[model samples]
Target chain A: MRIGCGAGFSADRLDPAVDLARDGALDALVFECVGERTLAFGHRDRRADPQAGYNTLLQTRLRAVWPLTAASGCRIVTNMGAANPMAAGRAAIAVARECGLRGQSVAVVLGDDVTSLIDADTPLPLSGCNVGDVGRDMIGANAYIGADAILPALETDAGLVIGGRLADPSMFLALLRHRFGWDAADWPLLGAGTLTGHLMECGAQITGGYFADPGHKDVPDLAFVGYPIAEVRADGTVTITKLPQAGGMVTTATVKEQLLYEVHDPARYLTPDVSADFSGVQLTDHGGDRVGLRGASGTTRPETLKVTVAFDGGLLAEAEVSYAGRGAADRARLAAEIASTRLQRVHGVTEDLRTDLIGVRSLHAHADHGLPVAETDVRLRVAGRFESRERAEAVLWEVESLLCSGPAGGGGFRGRITPSIVTHDAFLPRGDVPTRIEVLTA
Target chain B: MSQTQTLPLRAIAHARAGDKGNTSNISLWVNDPAHFAAVREQVTADAVKRHFGAQVQGTVTRHEVPHLHGLNFVLTAALDGGVNGSLNLDGHGKSWSFILLDMQVKVETGTL
Candidate 1:
């Protein structure tokens, strides 16, 4: 069986997916689009507008690839449904109709949303507090559903299968399981399939998109890096490669980097389908942008499903001003001090405010180990989180005031305010969240 | 003893960092197998914890993949509240891999 990755994340490039559908001759194209925060925002979108919870790019992506996949008989499996699979299903059908594609069906996998099941008393493991203790407005919760939830959808043999919070790798694993007729209890085979899924789920990551570093680890034609494709046998051994005409190389380095991407433990990588073990996985370089992998095994699936509970985290306000020419570092530092003092002393706001010198030290400054070097250019950024919009606006006002009131030669002031969402992990008994599948024809 | 020189880990390895909630995991792969032993010996959990300093709030655990000449460091409470809550622009800590790679290690002469 052959499979290709259409998307790695919710905001992935569309042209690459279109290229895969046109030339890949793939049996299935998996688009793993949902992330923890995207799902939370999806919930927020749904609350505001019922039809807006799905991927904002769902229609555009479908319009681009659905016709090509329909012509080639390559099925699509995706979590583009985000927080609302039913709405996403209808949207897909609409795209199919617009494309003049007939006899195409879409299967919607449901039951990942468990917002109604949770309450104020529900315990959150990561925050170490009850839901009520979060002291914020609750958005919603979604369990990370796996292959079992998606398997039935695949059984319908629909051209497209849509779901919400479907585990990233499960979309690929479900297609492989359906094609190979692999048993759910078969740990080793499931592990091998899961390994294949994990490798391909990130799309271009395994194909050298994120692996490029100039003068060190160089990737060819990185500007047009292609998504990944996998060829699997019944025994679960697989070779990962990309389209020949496309850019990016498939080597052991790229594969190894992706093998442990976001994976905490190689001995026991947990998923709802199985506890996959990538510890003993081996890679074989097949030359010409092809790498082979084998020996991934698993034990059992987790007893409980992991759910991401999202909350309205109020507003994040940010403001920045630039300082250049000689003594820029010192000027930026003084500006940061002024902004900090004014926000705290004058404004009487008491939220944790962060001051960053963009050019001199920002990301690593929190460690407090690096010394500031003399630089001609520096940008001072003041940021803070506030429960009220009025207080959040103070952060921007104080930083903007630095132009004339605090620092000399400061210019290029920019400010922004955005709604923020906080997510926490909670587990629910697998039995409580049963899945249902519905198929709609286009 | 054979001649050796201290060099940055980036000279011999490449790394990528990922995050889960408050935890951050960085996978470091040595470019040459000959330098894996030296990297494994020097890049211990405690060494990593000290290297990161206040950036990491919780314990650091390193998982070794000897067959692949790789080490996975899982740092807990490292993101300062992760993506949604953190004020840092790079809240995902995507650049943390370079921070790990910046650590210096002693390597055998002419191993590059």
Candidate 2:
């Protein structure tokens, strides 16, 4: 049984695999919803645009593909609802139960809220060593729940499931592997599938974007991006590939680049299961467009769990303006100073008015950061708290007006700093606890 | 004459085979000189010459570091650029995997 998982996002862009590969051959699919703009990455001083978080473009596209998936007969799951997975699940279950899928179970995995589970006196996980204390103020702590937890839901024969962040990719993987009864110790095979899941989890990693050959000349009309495909075997070996006729090159090099993409430790590539030593991975070109991946041995699984949460961090503000034309660099530097001084004089305080000549390193570093501001994007993001939401909402209105008043006409307002509770937390489920798995269908 | 190394399917599928030029890096143990001779004979220089093709410069040289308890070889460059090599990833070429396989040839314990 082929299992797959990927993050939720706008479908029209690149990374067509999750949307494209909804056929019957795929046993199950899990879509993870994370709010992001077109080019989500390191703090962009100027983001082109950002869509509303609650409004569901990611889900709309995800749901749009459902008819195709149902036609092909693939079970699905997701956490695209953000703060509303329960509501989203209810809506989806309504859709599933519509056509004789009532008993067709779809688990709604919650329990991400663990803010009060531990205690104020309880040691946080990342604290001092000698105390043996994990004392952490998890103002925001969600369950670092793993797919093993979702097995019960899938076992219930649920056709649809919704959940919070469970390491995202493992959503599709756990359900499919468990459905197929794939062995956990089957490291090589499991690793192959897991690797494929990892590549597809982010949608565009395996596509021509991150993994494309740098020196290769002719590209397969990148205007049309193709999604990746994994030929997962019963034995656990999965050969990842794209459409046979896709435009991008799916060589070992592209795969290698993706494998190396943002990995912290090559040897200790941690996950829910055992830790696989990525340092020892090998890629072979076994003819055709296929690149065979082999030998991904891992160590014992971890004792604790990891999680992500958001909470109220109060108000944070930022502002920047490009210093373009001649002496643009000096002009930007002066503008930032002026803005800082103006704010300080007005409110008896200086908000963080960061200035940049784009491509330049950073102001903290004395040297010319990187870009030589013939024209640079100047951005400022400031956050703060409000006695009331109305007061907080007023800041954006003020900044938009400041766009015209700032010394640099280029200085403009961008995105909103919505009042959000920045949550943060992680858990360490004891290894000995049989990791209870119960599947019930109604 | 390319030597054929009996490896678990994954070794090749993932391109884990060490590629020092053209010679392959392998994970095997030899308790005696005869075994080395056997390995040397079985995985001959001619094999290296045959696999990489003519673009490479010369005979492959084997390097066995006692520290590693493994064997690594460097072969000539065969398919240098164009269709394959040019793709740059993070400013590095995805052209080859010579060093990658060199590291995977781990001689497990209990085997002399």
Candidate 3:
């Protein structure tokens, strides 16, 4: 069976995915979205509008690809439900009607949410930070669910499966297990499948989307980069390839790069389903765009599941202005100094205050600090995080007011203040977080 | 045909970077499998730590993938506080591979 990746994350480009669904014949199309911050923002959105917690791009993505998925009879699976899968499922059915699909089944997988299970008394695993620290600022909490939680939805023959907070790879792994009827005890097979899911979970990462470097590793037509497709056999052996006529090229270089993407210990890559070992894996170019994977094994799943607790982290403000032409570097530094001095005078010396001269020393600020640079143009930026929005706005206020007051040639001033949601990742025993699935037919 | 020369690691390898919380993982792939021994000898964890200097806050662990002709360097405390809390514009450090690939190495002429 073949499974195609549509959208990797919540805000993935939708058009190319349509190309994957329409052109690539597939049994399922999975969209792995709903990250930690996305769910936190989703919680805020839900509080603002009780019915608006799902992915904001869900409708646009579904509307674009549902027609093709319906025509191909390819099932849809996604974690775009974020904080609200039921609402997202209903919205998918609504889009199905708009796409002229009849008698389709949409399912919502439940029981991933553990917000109520976690309290101030709960101990946060993996870090010294305690759950009590989140206190009243806690916005949402979710456990990473797995393939077992998603299998029941597939049993109902649901055309669309919407889930919330499942592990990114689980969406693709569930489709593989259900299609191949792999046993839960099939450690090696499950390991191989998990590896496939991990490689495909990020969508275009394995398909030459992220592997391009101009002169050295050139990829053709990256503007229309294609999504990946995995051909999984019953034995769990898989060959990954993209659309034959797609814009990108799939090589061993691209495959190996993604093989270790987001992976910590190559021998013990943990997901909810199984502990996958990819240290001994090999990638073979089978001619054409297909790259074959071998030597993946799995052990028993982790006893504890990771839980991400999202909290209201107050406000983050940033402001920037560009300085160009003669003595631009000096002028940019002067602008930064003025903004920094003014901000300190008004807001006091805070550890959160960050000043950077883009194009001179931004990313590696400490290493590049005090290093002289001669640039024709540079952007001076000031950013900070504050406990209160009132204080956060001071950062932008100091930089924006610099156009006429500070530097001789600062232009294109821009500033913004937004509420920030920081996450504290912890873990609870798998038994403490039970997962189940609920199906809803259209 | 094996004259000694100094060149950037990018001449013989390419790399990609990914972040997990505060720790950053960079996998360097050798363009030619024959140069795997050279990469293994030169690109030690201590060398990587020194190269990063103050940018890396914790220890560096190297995992060798001989089958793929690759070396995975997991650098701890490299991303400040990662995406959730880092103030840097490139919080995820997605382009850090370029920085890593820029590290120079001594190699035989025409080996790359």
Candidate 4:
């Protein structure tokens, strides 16, 4: 099953590709541990830093990918963007048994930690209350699998692979369905290898940001943007390389905007297993750096079962203060609506407690769910809860100690607002969702 | 609690001819292409061909895989009326399970 995929992008820097699983030269690594590259929620001062400090994004991605996947030998599937993947897969098998590596084989793919099984109380078909009061608030909750269930746990010898909240193309389709044992009625070659793991799961947008195609070449200097692979060919056809003399520029508009990211329709392309058709995804020109995606079609696999629940729904806070010159972004949205009407007259919110401004809808993408704000700064995200978590952590620790003496300036409240809550647990759908097929390897 | 009591598959999801006609570009569950990539990343195919591309007027086709309905849409006609939105077949909401997560999986269990 020869599977491999790597990355450690931050948390105290040191991603020499997690030393390819400590020298075996590759097998597993996908540690984001938190998430980054979005800033500009008015540059800085959403009460001092709304996010960007989950301890430098997941402690430098689990101290450089759980000690190179517990000291290497390859076999990884990471969602590193954690919301607790079983305590991040038991801190990645306690750093592969504290890097002892002796008898390795980790497995923690808890079907994307369903934020406490849908709720208002728990009777949900389509949000009708009773998922025991739902709010599993998510700006992110990674958990993706489907390289045919991680190449048979990396061809039986498993090493280090812990996942919760997958879908970075299920870590590149569990390394091409564990090195091509590929089946499940081969829906258009597993929907063209699940759109080639959704076109190399976002690495340099298929190698040239925003699908760079204005006559192509020139942008190769993208300060070192590479990372997109796919040789695939159990007959589903693929070849989108990057690395070897890498840099940037895999063109065809970077595999059509990385197969149009959160994609909607370019011909059915869904993954987990076929429903991919990017209208016969055709990108021809395969010479120098290769780029071929002839005819892709997919569909098949529906027995209903896709749950992600996170519970405990309570205790949340918010704050922010920043507004640079010239009406500094509308006076920082009138000081975040005067500190949410002064925390709605001191913690009184109820329309079913939901707040926004998570880095401006995660960087310009939430207008309907709110956050169309424009200015120098705005992190007025306010949350309230009461069925008690100690009265929602004492009104979210007094909404983070009223960011520098409550609302609008205490000099635009700078640094110190860390208050992330998590004790939430939920993962519904415990039956009948198995198309049933087997094989393994990361 | 919902052990073995929800199975009535009906599917529809169209959006071809370069898209955008007022609306109509469905997909809720046409036998799983990853659940149509999670329902076209949540009801999109350009918002289902612009919201239902005038009930798929010209009629677009392609969907023949062994229907197992978690859902799949194009309502324009109401039940299966063709141009979209109509539901004629049978079954209307409430019964599906799609949670195919493969996080950091590389299982071989032995022979490495």
- Lowest lDDT sum, 10 consecutive residues, model 2 chain A, at A37-46
Docking class of 2: incorrect
Rank candidates by TM-score, best first: 1, 3, 2, 4
Tell me the whole-model lDDT of each prediction, alpha carbons only: 0.91, 0.45, 0.85, 0.42
Which DockQ values do the candidates obtain, in the order shown? 0.73, 0.02, 0.59, 0.01
Rank the candidate models, highest lDDT first. Answer: 1, 3, 2, 4
Number of the predicted model whose DockQ against the real structure is largest: 1
lDDT of 4 by residue, A344-418 (tens): 566554423333343343221211322244544444444443444444443444445555555444244332222
Which lDDT tens digits does candidate 2 get at residues A161-262? 665545554665576467568666655544544565565665444555443322432346565555565666665455766565555656554565455443
Error of 4 at A410 (Å): 41
Query: For model 3, what is the error of residue A37's alpha carbon versus the real structure, in angstroms, after optimal superposition?
Result: 1.4
Q: What is the lDDT of residue B67 in candidate 3?
A: 77
DockQ-sorted candidate list, best first: 1, 3, 2, 4
| Local accuracy of candidate 3 as per-residue lDDT tens digits, A290-388 | 999888889988888988888887777889999998888899899888888877787774646788888787887655323357687799888887787
Task: Highest lDDT: give the candidate number.
Answer: 1
Q: What is the TM-score of each predicted model, taking all chains together? A: 0.98, 0.63, 0.96, 0.26
For lDDT, candidate 3 versus 4, the one ahead is 3
Count residue pairs with overlapping backbones in model 3.
0
Error of 1 at A181 (Å): 0.9
Better of 2 and 4 by lDDT: 2
Better of 2 and 3 by TM-score: 3
DockQ value for model 4:
0.01
For model 1, the superposed segments whose C-alpha errors exceed 4 Å read A366-374
